[model samples]
Target: MSKRWIGLVVVLWVTACSPIDPKLKQYLVEGERLYVLHCSNCHQRDGQGLRRVYPPLAGSDYLKENLPRVICSMKYGLQGEIIVNGIMYNQAMPGVPSLTELELAEIATYLYNSWGTQTGLIDARRIGPLLDSCARPRPRR
Candidate 1:
């Protein structure tokens, strides 16, 4: 191909791909800040949790399978034993009840997108119902 044609093809390829949404970018920035403040203590800034005590969020099978529970845990806290990857973790992660729905979405977005995961934006709209569902008490059978 001619140089001009090659250059044109490259430019078209670049322009054809959409840029990251501005809202997602903003959420990532804010989410990172929130993660640093609330989660970095145990999960670490790298998303690699402390060995044995905290499960690694970087490549967590638990996280991959438990989106609703993970979202609930952010607001209501998580307790008891859980398996992440293949290891068992039993620490009680304290809830940050003060976090708004949007904040939760931001944090979720950051976590899901970072550390080799790419689940995309966890919108605030999606968070509200999940929180409500978790808030309701389950009836005994």
Candidate 2:
């Protein structure tokens, strides 16, 4: 085989071996945009969050352990105490009730994958039923 054909096969193999799926890439792109619009103000552009007030999403234990709650909290808001990365945060986070289930999934996908977590696409289909089961009303300030 010619050198050009060998190079083409090598490129194809490398591309096939890539871990990032096209669907995951699309989710990540959409999620990043949604995160910027809805979450970045509090979470910060780097996911570091505001000091002491807004909890950091990067490698957050709460997020890892409480995927359902995190999803619910985005739409219904959170008030009370939660521990993240060994630190306790008691601040209230208002939900974006206007966000659709698909939008929430995109945001969740972004949050789960960005910073340090490698969790892939959070599908909108999964989010719909979860949102229905949230049950709790949005907290009153």
Candidate 3:
């Protein structure tokens, strides 16, 4: 095999080996825009949630540890207690049902990786449609 061919194969392999989901990256970017507009207030310009009223999300265990619950919170709404970064917090986090699965995925993924985390990822878009995906149930008349 030629050296150029080897280079091409290496490039392909790197792209293929990348664990970060392509859509996740897109969502994280979108989530950044949305976070600035919608979430940055409480979550802070950084991922750090408010002291008592909110909670620090940058190094949040909630975003990093409890993946499913975080997904549910974003999908529906969170009312009650949450523990993040080993700190306990009880607050009401309004659901973001308005967010598309892609959007939700992006925000969560972005927040998670933004912190001290170097691995573990959330593809919440893929979690869409699951009953526990979110809380706002479809209303039936």
By lDDT, who's the top model here? 1
Please give, for residues 1-141, the per-residue lDDT of candidate 1 as tens digits: 899999999999997786878899899999999999999999988999998998888999998999889989988788889999889999998889899999999999999999888888889899988887785324349
What TM-scores do the predictions have? 0.85, 0.83, 0.69
Query: Is 2 or 3 the stronger prediction by TM-score?
Result: 2
Cα lDDT tens digits for candidate 3, 1-141: 999999999999998897866665676678789778768878899776777778887766566567767767776778777667767888788777777766767776677667676554556546766535445655659
Residues forming the 10-long window of minimal summed lDDT in candidate 2 = 131-140
Segments of candidate 3 deviating more than 4 angstroms: 1-25, 129-141
Residues 47-121 of candidate 2 have per-residue lDDT tens digits of: 998888899999788889988899999988988998888888898998898989888888899899888778878
Off by over 4 Å in 1: 1-17, 135-141
- In candidate 3 the C-alpha lDDT for residue 19 amounts to 86
After aligning candidate 2 to the native by TM-score, how far in Å is the CA of 114 from where it should be? 1.3
Query: What is the Å distance of residue 40 in model 1 from its true position?
Result: 0.5
Residue 78 C-alpha lDDT in model 3: 81
Task: Report the number of backbone clashes for model 2.
Answer: 0
Q: Which structure among the candidates has the greatest TM-score?
A: 1
What is the number of backbone collisions in each predicted candidate, taken in the order shown? 0, 0, 8
